[model samples]
Target: MAADDVSVDDKVKRTRDLLSSFYSQDASQISPPSNTTSRFATLDTINTTSFDADQYMNLLVHKSNLEGLLQRHVEMAAEIKNLDTDLQIMKNNIVGMEVNMEQLLDKIMSVQSKSDGVNTLLFEKREHIEKLHRTRNLLRKVQDCKKASEEVMLVIVNKLEDKVSSDSESIQARAEAVMLLKQLDFPVEKLESKLLEKLEQFLEELDLSKDTSSDSANPHESINEGIESDSIPPRPEVPTREFVEAVHAYHVIFPDSEQHLVKLMHDLTTRHFEAAKQQIQEQVSSAKLSNRLRFIWTDVLSIDEVLPEAGLQDFAYEAARDVLKQYVTSLFSYLLHEISDALLQIQKDGIGEEYPLRAALEASKNALIQGSTKVLSDIRYLLDEDLGLVLKLRDMIISWVQEGFQTFFTQLNGQLLLLSGKDVPTDKVSSGLVLVISQLSVFIERDAISRITEEIGSSLLGGSYEYGSSAFYISMRTQRISVLLRKRLTTPNWIKHKEPREVHMFVDLFLQELGAVGSEVKQILPQGLTRRHSRTESNGSTSSSRSNQLRDNRSNTNRARSQLLETHLAKLFKQKMEIFTKIEHTQESVVMTIVKRCLKSLQEFVRLHTFNRSGFQQIQLDMQYLRITLKDNAEDEAAVEFLLDEVIVAAAERCVDPSPLEPAILDRLVQAKLAKTMDQEPVAS
Candidate 1:
């Protein structure tokens, strides 16, 4: 057993030595190991040489082991073969995928090319559609223009046909037709020449008709029989309708022709006015003048009728304006002469019981009013009620009236200067001034101003015309009249002396006028306002007395009620007196204004001129009288007192022979001149 263990150990040692040598072999020469090769060559050697028979017997005993190893190797080989087949299948799939990708790329390129073609087609089609739209729009416009042109031509032809066919058509219709043709851009030169020829023919026909009508009326008389008569027969009326139509047709064809007819009408009206004036001047009768003026105005109206209605009003206004200007111009000299004659009569006759100055002024005023009324009434008759034209004519007539009055006053003033001082009655002159101013005030207020206000107010409210400028013009005329009155009436030449008596006369007149105005106004003042006082009674013992006392109590109650009624009546009276009070106030203001102005002038005159002591005394006395007189008239007491002081001071300043006024006299003057409330103490040195 010991010997067998030693041999086994030796074989194990040899197997370890062999494994180490095999592992230590050079890597360069190394190869896969053979399946049959032994890792331990010593073991192989021992098995082959010493234990070969034993190992062979052991292998025969372990044949199942060798078969198990072979089965594992076979399973591993089968797994490797399956992996190789899967790899081949994977490679084939990759090739197929590459081919599919190429096919998809080819299809995308084709689609892209087709899309390019479509885009180009779309671009070309878009341009074509735009061109078609433009052509369609242009064709529509051309068709519209052609239709409009055809319609215009048709209208022109129709108008021309109507003008040729209708002989009885209105001048306005013919004119409108020609105007329409011109508006349609038709040539009108031939039409104008044709109208002129027709006008000439119509005039010739009118002349023939007139001659025939005259012959038929006066056939027995020779042609020279009426030629010797001083009065010429009335001219036949012109064939206005036919002539107007022809003229209007010409006007439509040649727009400048209207001016020619207007010029003709102007000349004709001028000739008629001149003829009327010459006849009236020769005859110099109011009836003849009025007749001639009426005739001329009627002629003017007829001319207006001949004109086209569209422009009739304007033409008539112009004609009437011109005629009025001519008529007023021609009549101005005659009117002035008549006014001068009337004033001369006043100067020669003196204002007697008749008050010739008042009569003369009334005559002049009447003439002016009549003349204006006549002219305006004619204008109203002739022209349409165009407020603008009416206002314009009214203004012109007002200006003419103002001029006439101005001329009359200017001449009258010159003539009044020719009167000797003795011949000129101071009372008459003062009365004339008051009368004239009052009459003028009433006339202007009633006739001119009220009428103007009514006309302008009506026009403004009715919206017929803008009266702003017209109102301003009328206001200027009113101011002109005021200025004229002040200039002519207030001259110092009319007085002839700067005497205190003469100066005080105006003051007396002013006071008297104010007194009259106040008296007239006071009549309408509230009355019956007497104050009552409480009464103390003595006692009487009687039953009848007691009954009498009861009756007295009832009477007292009735008186109380009557007093209440009087209060209400007084209120009504105040309301009714408002306008009269205003007029009275106005008169007072006018008188006061004149007084102040005259007082100022007198003061200046008194300062410049020397006055004797006697003159001063007279003036002082007169001022004292005036002061007392003004007290009852509600005159401004302070103003009156101030004026008195100024007059006294001026007289003192201009006193020639006085050393100084006596203190007593100065005190007296101051006491009279100062207001009643002023101290009556003597003035200190």
Candidate 2:
């Protein structure tokens, strides 16, 4: 109030006098506070009223000499300058406030002018409203709120429609639009349907793109045929950038459709793999199946890197795993189915008298090697390529690869694997799938696990190899080979034959099969360490399972052969011999098992049948030739010799009046046969 009482001219003059005294450079120019003549003013720590510049200067000099005096003088000057600055700032602030106040006043005046005009118009309207109908005005008032709400809904829908694009921005806009519509009590069914349509369109475009890609003269087919081909194949175009954009847009829009998204990824991957498979020429395609999948593995990893990771972070990996598993399943099924069909057709068409057992088996081996190679490659890629970040799915898939192959063999068609309980006729070439699968199992056990261990740069497949599925394959292959052997050697035709001629034809036929099995083993397995084996068969009462283990145990002569034991004795010629089993996947190991099992079958036949001297001498001739032949073919020549001698002993034991063949006569017969086999017809060259 007192400041308001002073005139502007007087205030300016008073301020000039105060500022002039501060800079006058005289000690007496400074003034002390008076507190407006009030009684409440009290002395504080600085003691301003008693403060003397010369006294403070003397105290500083006494404590710190000339530097302390000069420091104290500078501090006092700083305080004075700060006080002056505060006053100047306050004056400027007041001036700024005054300007703001004037602007506010101008705005108030403008508002007042508008209010006056509005009031004048309202007064005129009030006078006119008194003359209008009351009913129409009431109707207009009631409709106002409804019309406003509906118009707001329309505006939001239009904004949302504009945002329907293949981008994250569109997804965000759609979310906001849907939320607003829900808040405003509006139905969003149309917009949601539109979005669903976009999702389906994306999936369809992806599928169609994949389908179109396969409709051309692809060069990959020619590569396996040893022909030169270009890298670029004539195929349908793929939607590259659009595909990524579509993926980014749909995941957020349809977050709950995780299964749908997974299926979409699955379809894309499966289509890719199938196309790759179809690109290989069927004639030479077996060896290339694994190589194609290696490229697919790289592609899958790259896709995992590219796909949007929002809600579907693991979708690509899930798709790849599912696709890979199905692809493997398809490989087994196709190989089995193809071989089975060929055999059936061959039978139906009467192509051969016997299952071209050797060729049929060789085909199966080649197919399985490619399949195992494919699985191994996929495992290597998953573990070595950014495994930690690409989702912790590496081990899961690798385990599947390792375990799945083993389990698959257990389900193989029994008849195809030569497991038929009924008699398999000698003419039917037992399809070699059982043996191929067995060799495949050995491959995983001996070679695949080793390579996988090396590939991971770890210690031996992470740890010691679990028995896993290799054991099943080995057991099965053994069963099938045993079945194939007994079906021929122990048949009524072979056991009850009344012949006294050249060595039994079954020996040569059985040897041919062994050669084929050995050849296949060489292709798919490592050159395993040679193992020396010593085995003897025993005839005794036993359960079904006991017979399974006796392939590793012994036989007694006085024992009355029981159910399973009698079957075993007859299967192996009633002599001590190694049964068909899981041997190393090597040429020698596989062939030796077949030979031992075949010899065992011969021994059982000799013991079961009542043969005269002629039958005994015929058996003796075959045994002596095998003694020479098997020594070279068998893994352990000593075991072969011992087994061959036992077969003769079993025949002699079972013979009626077994007259021993003279040494000179036996040599002449064996030599004649050996020379027949050794002599080669002259070549045209």
Candidate 3:
């Protein structure tokens, strides 16, 4: 019972406490406001309400209702708390979204500002482009104006050129006319003055008139005098009958005489026909005739019926008289040409020595002189043409004098050599023969001077065939025995021309010995023997047969090799000669520039000697070793250090240093290695 009572009391206290809990009170607030609804309350007020049974029976029923309501309110409070958490999260998200919106607005404003700036720039640029277009149009107009001006200037220049050309030609023509007038002694100004004076006098006479009646008696007397003069003209200077007869004679002889007779007649007459005929006939009969010419032309022809040498003099003389100086010059030229042809024939005919056409040559020379004299005299009469004729005649005569004697002397020397059994005369030689050589020297010297003058104007001491070893050889060969004449002449102090003074007997002996030695050398080694070789040989029987074949093959190969080498070497030598001559003629600066280029190119070719595999490999290895010694701390420097050093050293050594070139030594060692290539190549053969 005590436990039950105690339990009851405890239960009552619990029930009362539970009822109080169901109608819980709020803290921090006395009561809800009169306007506030009881249905809702704050969370702190709801947490105080908790245990409820039935609100202690009857009151428990109302309490139960209150408790159920309180329970629903508690669940509602939990849902509200969850809704508050969701609302807090949503508020934070909305704040973040507002910040993002502010950022986006700032970005949009910035982009708009940039667009506005770009538009402003574009507008400014467009204005500048328009300005440039305007400038271009103005420049185009100015350029057009300039081009038009240039065109006008060019046309003016062309017109000026044409005018200048025409003026130049007119000036030239006037100068030529003046020269011709001077030659003819025309006195053009004096003649013009005299003609003007005569016209003025005639005009004055016409201007002066008189009365016919007062001067009638004078006029009648004048008329009577004029009629008397006309009737008997004082027996003119030359009679009409004489003039008519002379013209008739001239007409008859006109077919036979060319300009010679016409010129003579014209000179004598000057309008008096009879005087010209008388003078012409006297001059023709007085001309001299050659006797030697008569002997050869008449004698040679009469001897041989098949071989004819006639009408040469008459033809030569007639040609001279008809063509005057031109004919004579042509005759001399033809004589020289004939001599050259005869010499060529002598060589071709193998006439050997011991014989020469001396008589025939002498006859031809006599005929040439007679013809030459006639033409020269006739040319003298044509004073205007004479200077040209004299020059041509001198050139032709000089040529004939040089060539004719040269041929004669050369042939004579050969004959003498053969007759004397190649024993050239070592004693006092003939002066006449030496004189011929001296004449040749003079001719060559004069020709050289004239040729050089034509090419480079007058200069002192013009180019010459240097009288040296070559000159001595030519003199000796041309005048084999006559070479000894220089010694006899040299001893005499009176001798002025010492050009061919020395008589070297040793020259003849040397030539004879050289000729013999050359023949022996030619017979022994021949040519291209170095090209033929073999290491192996067969047995006796085979060797005999094979040796003959081998010899025949070698002979043919040697001959071909000799020919090819000769031909190629000749061509190469000729090219080298021409190049050397050209190089000598070129300016110093041009040669230096060319040599520089050649050396640079040669250096490039020489650099090819360093091979890529072994040579370049060893070079790279040595370079690496050199770099290691240079700087131990180097990283990338090791790669390029040696390259720099080597390049600098090589350039300094090759370009800065001077060295002697041993050609013989280089050729044997250096060129020997290149022999295989040099053999097939087209260099210097």
Per-residue alpha-carbon lDDT of model 2 for 575-617, expressed as tens digits?
3333444444455765565566666666775677776656767
Instruction: Assess each prediction's global lDDT (C-alpha) against the native.
Output: 0.48, 0.52, 0.34
* Winner by TM-score: 2
lDDT of 1 at 459: 30
In model 3, where is the ten-residue run with the lowest total lDDT? 577-586
If ranked by lDDT, best first, what sequence of candidates would result?
Answer: 2, 1, 3
Q: Judged by lDDT against the true structure, how good is candidate 3?
A: 0.34
Best by lDDT: 2
Q: What value does the lDDT take at residue 177 in candidate 3? A: 38
For model 1, give the 10-residue run with minimal summed lDDT: 534-543
For TM-score, candidate 1 versus 2, the one ahead is 2
Report the number of clashing residue pairs per model.
0, 17, 2
lDDT of 3 by residue, 329-390 (tens): 34345444453343333234454544434433333344334333333333222221222223
**Each model's TM-score?**
0.25, 0.28, 0.15
Q: 500-544 in candidate 1: lDDT tens per residue?
A: 322334444445444454454355433223221111110111111
CA deviation > 4 Å runs, candidate 3: 1-119, 157-392, 395-685
